[model samples]
Target chain A: MKADTNLSEGSGIPAEARKILTQIETDRAAYKRKLVISFIILAIAMIMVLIALKLDFRFMKNQLPFIFAGMGYTLLVSFMAISLACFLAVVGALGRLSKNPVFNSIASSYVSLIRGTPLLVQVYMWYLALPQIGKALEGYGFTGIQAFFTLPALTAGILALGVCYGAYMTETVRAGIQSIDPGQTEAANALGMTRSQTMKRIIFPQALRVIIPPVSNEFIAMIKDSSLVSLMGVWELSYRAIKMGRRHFQSLEMLITVALIYWMMCILLQYFQEKLETHMARGDRSIR
Target chain B: MMENDSPMVKITNIHKVFPQDVHVLCGIDLEVKKGETVAILGASGSGKSTLLRCINFLEEPTAGTVEVDGITIEAGENDKLRNGRIRDIRKRTGMCFQAFNLFPHMTVLENIIEGPVTVLRQKKEAATAYAEQLLQWIGLSEKSDEHPSRLSGGQQQRVAIARSLAMKPKVMLFDEPTSALDPELVGEVVEVMERLAKEGMTIVAVTHELHFARDVADRILIMDNGNWVEQGPPEKIFNNPEQERTRQFLAHIL
Candidate 1:
């Protein structure tokens, strides 16, 4: 391989430089070969997908619009839930990090309890158990309590998801805040800034750069997790797919279609996550 | 210079004890007159930095009082200093750290202006103008918009100095400001401190750089085991120290 470097010989380049260039050219060729192999693998996966569909393309095409219509609800639940989760995570993290015993216990218990229980059970508790508690209160002469407790399916789904994810994200947020050096806090304090002021202006802003990427990752997972809301009889993508599949007795087809849709949505979100990571990292000299 | 006899900073019997009976500072007392520079020299863990931190209450003294620019804070079990009182003392004293500790998320100019705008509630434009001037003084005007991570260690330390100066503090505290820098880069930061000292800024520094202490400080104090072993003018302390401990420490370092 080294003997074939006549390309740069006439350009008066040194032997060491020409050898390095040859290595780079070899690397580029290997990368191109790998790219071609990756595409072939993807083509094989597509063929597997076709076999899984059992050549029922017409049925999938016809059901696509009906299932796609529920996408709005799916996205809405995830977005609103994630927003609520972020707010709760910040508060919970602060609570967990607080010096006061009461705040610390409340934050730790919230995380422990939520994370310990199953999300499905929590969803049912929000949609079903709350109304029962409200009814019990109504028996004590609390007028309109049952009605207030009985939430719509979408609202209950968002609450359950948000509370659950908030518990998980509390740890993430706490780790991000702790990742910052203590010197930063001392510097801010030395400048006469109050504790809260230091946190708001100096600590939190820097922590956000560390927290955003993982938070985005949680968001992608929530997109798929939002499907759990379908059990509440909401018209989200999964509910619509399951309902249509049962009606037409093609459950496998509907399930496969909905799975692909969720995968696509996550891919789109991952793209946006990379863009956000880059934006947050602008202060750093290294882009990646 | 002798006309102003009032002390800019006064400390009385300050004692600091860490948990588990680690007595880091014990019964230390000192005073600095206005416009005078005091340099403290000691081996590491001798409480030199802790005493400086006590001045701004970054490390609260378990006993004794620290009075800065006429405001006094005393340590006692029943008497807790209010938040406002701590802020008042902190605002009057500027601190420069060995690691620079510049806010990595902000540009150099923003880092400088942060204390002015947030703590002092100065107008943004006015704070920025002062920050720019400080940057120019430190010869970092060209790097104003750059983040602290992008600058060299020397440049970041200079920027850190500028950040402290933006608050217009009555006194400056340097905690081994040049100890973290490369040997070649230490000169730039030391030069800035020398310039500041010459301009009549009151400074108390804990440093390992012997040249900086000798050339820049008006008075020098040597500490060992949380107590001052010797104190005098730099020439007297460096050439003819009274204490055996101070002599040994200097012999090891110099």
Candidate 2:
């Protein structure tokens, strides 16, 4: 406070300006203090609730290593699936934007069919129904078809998640692409750029800035949704937690532990997403 | 064979009808000779901008033909052929919009070089060199690395003109280039345009600035509704327009 006054006086700030600055500084200090107090209160409330719940800390600790070990598979599936989803989303968005009726119909139908069905049903179809169809195809004398259709649990999980998320992300991608001003396209066209050239050089670059935050959001949701693979015996986080809990008769403890783990992973992803948002927004003067 | 005498830009019976029967351009015929500057003055919604847009096929005309530099694209042609011809016309014509639609993602130099590098397939180094020269000509060499959003409206408009010029187009089309600028900032953009005009660039400008029309334009055309009512030398149109519609329009604006 002394230093602030000294600087203000040395700088010869007007009295009115000095008063406003001091008020702003005081408000900032009060805000910081309030935030700290709120955090402490929340932390205490969480501890009290946990104590009241009488959770099995010892059992939860024993199961931690096994459940944590499954994080690798969870992250691996999510990473691969998100990559596939991104590729499909770009292709789907292009198809949606295409003037060709055939492409538009196919893209719209894909989005509709996938989004209309439940992810659980889609997962079951990938894991179980595909092999049945392959067998039926084999009955038609198509050799080696069953082998092609019979995917491993991991591949089926990735496919289900990727294809499902791809449909949703297609709309996100389309909105992002459409968010660009039509003048940008006209400018590119006036400069003699072909449609594809304009899309690649001008439209997509601008659209990616608008698309990324939501894409990251979808990815975070995908991380949790990946637990659906546990139903297919993929032995991921939830799978391991469930197996351990049933064996030890500490289902509540294990469930809560796994939930916290998922929460923590999402938090980490959210932190990185914020960093990326800031990085992408650096060029936009309006945001600052 | 008589390239010097032939019109550089010729529009015959150009008509543009938007959906729901909005006739934006109606049977407009215009001819711009080589190195000639034509200023089209009109009030808001007078279709002057639409007429300019139709020249480059930015807005496809409902009916008519646009011939730029001996290449003609007629309305209702086969899609593939018409698109190819439209591209050819666009290649030869540089357009400056009222909104100064510089690619917000690119720096000033990058925005100028994008057309040459991507469309013209020039070497990046050569495009950059030319862009730098154009930037200097526009007196925005210091803003080469700055993004469009960082620049003022006038600066952005000047950069937009420089971006168009880097293409070395046969004809420059300005669609109310100074309309979006602050009153004080309009002169910089106007000055740059005046320089381009003095350098003998073939230009078709749709504008409201009466002074620019009077001083720089070789011919002045006053448009009302969707058709030009009076067209002549700057003095004749500004001082002694023969049409009552032109007189009324001039009176309102002046």
Candidate 3:
């Protein structure tokens, strides 16, 4: 018994250490099983890809580079449109939160009208109707109205997408602003801050934490919805793919390639979104 | 109650009726002289907190006149002042919350200096220097760089008091500053308040701690159903009961 005790102590592996080692082993085994499952799923995905490649992919092979080149336009339009949307969303959120009836009604109408109509219809309206108004203005001897009304197809598409997305994002921003505890506002007021000062100094900083995740989600969705801009004859990813496929009568191959590219872009965006979430949650981690 | 000096804070016939005719504060009249620490004690929903909140216009009294350091604001039925006057009144009063509502995104030092630097338009370095002193006074100098979320309940409340002090308001309002604290954490906050009282700070506190009221408060006001049931020196309020309601409340809480 003494030898056994001495050996165990000398080896530095006590009962508690053995228990921890067993727990670690179980955890590692569970992780290994998950890895195996992921590999199986990846293999299935690879097999599907092989089957798709075996199909009539000659047109896709020739056109993939050109369609991929259009990724730049797709990204550029999405970036500009999303930037514009964020600005409009902030302004709309303020209007929604404002007590003034004029601002309130204007914001309410904008959101109702935009959200009520489909994006496709709005794109057409911007692309088609504005130039008609420009021509009518020219007929009425308002020659300077040309710049105001006659927007290029790309410009119209961007504005329509921005305005429509802004309407949806307004509600998200409003909810985020309101979700902060009333106690925070009360505290700010009791500290002698005016309403705007309170909002700028205390409330908005906190609200941004809750607002960012959903806003990032909207951005991801915006990248995909940007395809609708292609309807206005903007040479983006989907437009290039469609044009190429129709010319070669192999629409399925070109469309599938575009879909894969979109999937890859979305995956990349999700990875960055997770990193941003971790960065934002740094201050909250200690307490949680 | 003094002859020559004006009241540090005075509220006359303040009334608050919420929507659906629920009267939260019904005709509260109060006066606290300079250097006086008054404790208003009552059970939850008894309107003690509401009365305290109304003094700072945190809840706009449906009817009342409030004077802080002789600057007065009056409100009647459908009569309200512009945001300017409200802001003016609030600047003269510093309030500490029960939840220690420090701006979580800011460090303790930043929370302390925000009001002074922004509303008061004090120089940032001067405000920061003063904040350092206040933090030191509250025994939180070491934690100035840390965020509120990382601090314990007691530490957060102390930093909150320091934040209020940084504004240099004429009077301090504490709304049950320790009611949310852990049992072990309550004493630290109470000790800080005790020190503030000894240093002659004008304070109106809505509190649940009977011992704090009995020991530190110059006067004790007991409320029930939005009315003050009793008000007197702490010894009289604690030892020589005048109203049955006061006695019952003491029995329940103490």
Candidate 4:
């Protein structure tokens, strides 16, 4: 309370307001400590549940190799989808930020439509509607119709996920770009750098510091969202789990096994995210 | 057509209006010959800074014609100067900012060399060599490798001047270059500007430092309410101001 009063005195904030703020800070810290203890207890309880199910876990053990094999596919799909999403996100961010009415409208519409509709519906659209268009093109005697529009389920899943995530990431990218002080751009312009040159050399490089952390978050979320692709018959973690569980009527065990694997994968992704954040923050003097 | 006789910077009938229809600069006309230093003094909202910014198209004049180093550009129907001509005009002038915008991510040396290497297509080795020279001139040779964030306010501002000078522009513009510095730090930046003036760099500066204006300026112009209210030599303007507003302003600031 003495420290709080001293801080309030120096800041010129009323003592009453400082008291309320100090109370809120104390309450939040206490809540966080309690939450940490609760999480440890929850982990112990989960381990006990695993021990109780050890008797019937033999079948789940046998299926682990089959389901674990799907990790490779999940990583591959997510990697490719993220790459595509990064490209689309840059273009979408530019369009949204551009002064041209046409570009602004197009970017706004794409983000609105994709965010408004369900990802599930978009996935199904790619799988079903694309082939219908292919057939229609074949009737019209388009020579490359078969190859161009013959949409594979895996490809459809990747495209759907990429497009959906790209829309969300556009907002993150735009905000990162906007966070830079306008004075930096004015200085660059005064030095005679073209608009494109300024963006490539000054703006984007600086924006990467703000962008990388959120982008890594999106990548982690994308790993979980990749499971949605299983609906299209892709042999990812969830799809394999469903098929094996249904064949032997061990659905609960199969589902629990895949969930644990997903959790472990997220933990690994989180470690990488922190490493990347630290790397990007190297030039920032305040971080150390 | 008057190539040799024209002033280095000749701005004709400039006006600036914001989107809300607030006229910040109203029908301003000015000229600066080669090797002449003009200081603009005004109250905070008098548009002196806006007038300096328009010379290089940093803040495009809402309506005007600007000619710098024999190249003329007029604001088109959309109230924007042609992009090509704007870049051309900007290349002919170096601008120092109030806040010392020195590209915080770069070291002092890198900030100075960036313009020449990127815009002028100079070799990296040559740009770096010249940047080292500039750092020496600013009395900051030891601080070249240090980032802007690591330097003191005075050091940062000196580096900003060195950064602008690297371009080798025909004229230099200073927009309240010392207003953001501490009282103790303002002297160092003013020292550098004084050195530049002695070396005959054509300069147009908007400043609140009247003593700096009185000591270094050839001509001093006073602006108020979006237009020029008085103009004369520094001695005449400071010692024998004819207008009541000029006398009042000088009395307050002096």
Prediction RMSDs, each to the true structure: 3.0, 2.3, 4.1, 5.0
The per-residue C-alpha lDDT of model 3 at residue A268 equals 98
Best by DockQ: 3
User: What's the residue-level lDDT of A49 in candidate 2?
Assistant: 93
Could you tell which candidate, 1 or 4, scores higher by DockQ?
A: 1
In model 3, the runs with Cα more than 4 Å from the true position are A1-28, A39-46, A49-53, A56-59, A135-143, A286-288, B1-4, B77-81
Which model is ahead, 2 or 4, in terms of DockQ?
2
The model with the greater lDDT, 3 or 4, is: 4
The TM-score measured for candidate 4 stands at: 0.91
- TM-score per model for chain B alone? 0.97, 0.98, 0.96, 0.96
Cα lDDT of model 4 by residue, A115-169, tens digit: 9999889988888888788888888988678678768888988899999999999
Residue B58, candidate 1: alpha-carbon lDDT: 88
Query: How well does model 1 score by local distance difference test?
Result: 0.92
lDDT of 1 by residue, A220-256 (tens): 9999999999999999999999999999999888998
Q: Give the CAPRI rating of model 2.
A: medium
* TM per prediction: 0.94, 0.96, 0.92, 0.91
Q: For model 1 chain A, where is the 10-residue window of minimal lDDT?
A: A1-10
Off by over 4 Å in 4: A1-39, A52-55, A139-141, A286-288, B1-5, B77-81
